[model samples]
Target: MRHRVSGSRLNMPHSQRVALMKNLARELFEHGTIVTTVTKAKELRPFVESIITRAKKATTITQELGTKSTGSPEAMELKSRNLALRREINRNFNDRKLVKKICDEVAVKYLTRNGGYTRIVKLGMRRGDASEMAVLQLVDSEEKKETK
Candidate 1:
């Protein structure tokens, strides 16, 4: 019966599922890594990746334009494009500071790479329910490794 349906419902209603994802994403952004159910981690991977891509795009636009915030028509156009990307991301995330951090810092770190922003590591099973658990984390950028 369930042939082409995409995405797990997680046995939750639509609103709750969205809220759960939002909370998980917020925590993941703040801490860099989170331990969660395997199922949740799988679902969160694509969601987080897409957001990072958008943030990366915004960062890219700003970088390409550099300090040219005004004057030229091209600069204005790029600025608008960057603003639109940020606004789209802001719609999903509640905290402005978090959104800023994503665009300015997190995305910048991954600008050199393409996709594969997150990694999910299996952590065996939870004792209470025996559900499979995993650690979802952002992949470390090469720049950070060189600095350390």
Candidate 2:
């Protein structure tokens, strides 16, 4: 009867699953990479991509708006108008800055890649529960020699 179930449950409850995803996403953003299970890495790919896509779109919008605003004589007319426009642009810039930093510096490191941003190296099995173990990492670091 599990006909329409789309995503792996990983035997976790809904809230915990969401929290885990969020935490993983945050870690990936902060570290530009992570080591996790294959299943988790596969799941995190689309989730992280969506965030990066939104950030790229936001940056595009900011660029377009900045170009439009600065091209008009009205932008130079009144101080208040200029201030308002600057405020709007600044808000957009701030939003895009965080996105750009994460997307450009972190995500772009994997730019040539079409997909498969992560890799999974099987690590045998867990001791307690005997579940399969794997190490999931960002693909860009694949060639970097492991220190230990």
Best by lDDT: 1
Model-by-model lDDT, in order? 0.93, 0.59
Structure candidate 1, residue pairs in collision = none
Q: TM-score, each model? A: 0.93, 0.59
lDDT of 2 by residue, 1-148 (tens): 7899777887899878777877777777667567667677667677766655444444444444565666566434433443444344334334445454654465545544556655567787678887666665555644465643
Stretches > 4 Å off in candidate 2: 62-67, 71-100, 107-114, 141-148
User: What is the per-residue lDDT of model 1 for residues 17-117, given as tens digits with 9 covering 90 to 100?
Assistant: 98888889989999999999999999999999999999999998988889675789989999999999999888888678999999999998898888999
What is the lDDT, from 0 to 100, of the residue 126 in candidate 2?
73
RMSD of 1: 1.7
The worst-scoring run of ten residues by lDDT in candidate 2 lies at: 85-94
